[model samples]
Target: MKKTPHASPAAAAFVLAAALLGAAAPAVARDNPVDPVSNPDKLDYRDVEARRPDFKEPFLRDGVVSRPERFREIKPGITQAQVLAVLGQALKQQRGALGTEWDYHFKFQMPQSANYLVCQYKVVFDDSQAVRSAVWRRRQCLDLLPR
Candidate 1:
């Protein structure tokens, strides 16, 4: 059988695919340079620094602290595996301050949502350079409000 101009299989398939993909594509999120970062309101670091609320943390654990049920306790010398084990259960972030005195913060995102909260934990050591208290210290839940 000869294919008609209006009944071309290639064109029909193209049209069907385009229609179906067009309907489904909007549901996906595209992150291009043109695309704005999600949740501009949630950007709090700048705001916090701007206000300059004395960064002085008197106590070792100044912020909220939650012990992970599944993660293991911080033993005498924290290795990447120990830290990663807790992080694996909690949030994920770019590994930083590997040797600095800076607080290692992780952003644990909330239930399949765009919400991200901060969890702060520092690797501490004694004067003898022995890791005496290296654990997840303070965790400030950024997305405390209802979704």
Candidate 2:
């Protein structure tokens, strides 16, 4: 009679864990597919609106004004770390690294007026986590750009 060898208890546990994790991988990927966008390289507010019809900008915080110059620094292909350096942290509503979109509430002073215009800024990231495009919720916010 030939004797059969058995896996050690620790080795068996490791194999079981590996099998369970391997089985879950596909389902996880399917459940959280990367979001797709039209013209990912040139996404705009219209695309955002099309994908998030019910999305609304959060209320602006008092005394917190975003500099237009800093916003100008945000360009396509920039990394998230660069964005953080330029714009600080995004709004709490943003899902951080787990999400592809980061939202910001910006308030700018109206030229020669006491009131401030609040705009929502959105930064879209590609699958590689690089900035793909940026847009403002309102078209009028473009006026903030320096001529």
Per lDDT, the best of the predicted structures is: 2
TM-score of each: 0.30, 0.54
Measured with C-alpha atoms, the lDDT of residue 57 in candidate 2 is 50
Evaluate candidate 2 by giving its C-alpha RMSD to the native, one decimal. 17.3
Error of 1 at 55 (Å): 19
Could you list the CA RMSD of all candidates, in the order they appear? 16.4, 17.3
Q: How many backbone clashes does candidate 1 have?
A: 1
Q: Report residue 126 deviation for candidate 2 (angstroms).
A: 0.5
Off by over 4 Å in 2: 1-63, 92-99
Candidate 1 lDDT over 57-131, as tens digits, reads 433222333434433355557654564555443222332233322245554555578755555544444444444
Q: Give the per-residue lDDT digits (tens) of candidate 2, residues 13-102.
A: 999999998987864232211223312233333122223644455532432586677777888899999999888787743433434888
